[model samples]
Structure formats: structure tokens, C-alpha cells
Target: MVTAIIMLSVEKKHINQVAEKLASIKGLSEVYSVSGPYDIAAIARVQNNDEISELVTQHLAQIDYILKTETMLAFKAYSKDDLEGMFSVGA
Candidate 1:
């Protein structure tokens, strides 16, 4: 799975609206209204890199409330399975 974090910069007045709209998209997992240079942050898991482009262009960019966005792709993840295996003393 390809995991991506999309940081959205929205107009102050449109923060909630933008977050709500983001929630409607299929791949988007979570959306948070944040306090920082960006107004909102979201996490998504996609099937491939191409879908990222489609998500950014076709979905996100079309939202009037979203002014800009920054995306970070994760190459690896630390899951509960990883932790469990690491801490296990014996089989």
C-alpha cells in the first residue's frame, strides 16, 4: 500500500468545509483541522503513485476552499506486528 500525508492550506473561513469535503473522497482516511502554516492535514492510502496525481488534480485541486497542498509519501510503516515480533522473547 502506498501511504501519503496531504497537508492542506485553506482559507481560514473554509477550514471546516474543506475538511468535510476531504472526508468524502474514497482514499482519504482521516482529516484534521489543524493550527499551523496549513489549515488541515489528511492521511490516505492509495493503490499506486498514479492515483496520487489523480487525487491531487481531480479531487483536491477542484475544491475551492483549498488554496495549496503539500504531500509526503511514506516508504515504510511501523505496525503492531512489527512491534510484537521485535519484543517476543521466543517462539
Candidate 2:
């Protein structure tokens, strides 16, 4: 799976409504209201890069209240369970 982290700045009055809309999108895994330069954080897991492109430029662009977005592609995720699993392969 391809994972993308999308940070969004939305119109203040529409923050809640925009978050709800993001949660309903098919490839989006989670939506959060956050504190920072961005108003919302969205995690999307999809089959490939093409879907990520379409999701941002097509689906997300269609939302009326989103002011700006920054998308970052994840290279790897580190976790204790995953690390342990990798080292325990022969045990």
C-alpha cells in the first residue's frame, strides 16, 4: 500500500464539516482536527501513486472549504512490533 500524509488548511468555519467530508472518502484512512499551521491532518492508504494523485487533485480539490494542502509521501514506518518481528525471523 502507498501511504500519504496530507496536511490541510481549511476555512475556520468549515473545519468540522471538512473533516467529516474527508472521513467519507474511500482511500482516506483517518482524519484529524489538529493544532498547528494546518487545521486538519488526513492519512490516506491506497494501492498506488496514481490513486494518491487522483485523490488530491480530483477528490480533495472538489471540496469547497479547503484553503491549502501539503502532501508528503511516507518512505517507512518504524514500530516496536515491526522491529521485533524482523529480528525474530529465525527464532
Candidate 3:
């Protein structure tokens, strides 16, 4: 599986509404409203890198209040107990 962290910049007044809409998207794993260079952040999981790219371009980038997005593809994970048993490590 592939995972992405999408950082979103949205219009101030639409923050909550946009977050709610993003949460409803099928592949979205989580959403948060934050204060920073961006207004919201969302986590999504898909079977491939191409799938996540397509989803962001075909859907997320088109959401009404979203101004911009920066996506980070998650390559490795460690130290988080909640995710400790979630994936197998290989060398």
C-alpha cells in the first residue's frame, strides 16, 4: 500500500467545511485543521503511488475551497506504537 500526507491551504472561512468534505472521501484516512503555512492536512491510503496522485488531481485539487496542496509520500515509518504492528520491515 502507499500512503500520502496532503497539506492543504484553503480559504479561512471554509476550513471546517472543507475538512468535513475531505473526510468523506473514500480513501482519506484522517483529516485535521491546523494553523501553519497550510490550513488543513489529510492522510490517504491507496494501492499505488499513481492512485494517490490521480485522486489528488482528479478530486482533491478540485474541491471548492482548496487553494493549493503539497503532498508527501510516506516511504518509511518507525517508533510509533500504534503503527508498530501495522507493517512488516524488510532489508
Strongest candidate by TM-score:
2
Candidates ranked, most accurate by lDDT first? 2, 3, 1
**Candidate 1 local lDDT, 1-91, one digit each (tens):** 5779999999898888889999999888789988889889998777789998899889998899788899999888777576334333353
TM-score-wise, the better of 1 and 3 is 3
Candidate number with greatest lDDT? 2
Score each candidate by Cα lDDT: 0.84, 0.92, 0.86
Tell how far residue 25 is off in model 1, in angstroms. Answer: 0.4
Q: Which window of ten consecutive residues has the lowest lDDT sum in model 1?
A: 82-91
Q: After superposing candidate 1 on the true structure, give the runs of residues whose Cα lies further than 4 Å from its correct spot.
A: 81-91
lDDT of 3 by residue, 1-91 (tens): 7888999999999999999999999778799998889999999877788889788999897789899999999898666485524543441
Q: Write the per-residue lDDT of candidate 2 for residues 1-91, one digit (tens) a residue.
A: 6889999999999999999999999889889999989999999888799999999999999999999999999988766566335434555
Q: Please list all clashing residue pairs in model 3, or write none if there are none.
A: none
Error of 3 at 48 (Å): 0.4
Report lDDT (Cα) of residue 12, candidate 2: 100
Query: Candidate 3's error at 17, in angstroms?
Result: 0.7
**Looking at model 2, how many pairs of residues clash?**
0
Alpha-carbon TM-score of each model against the true structure:
0.83, 0.87, 0.85
Ranking by TM-score: 2, 3, 1
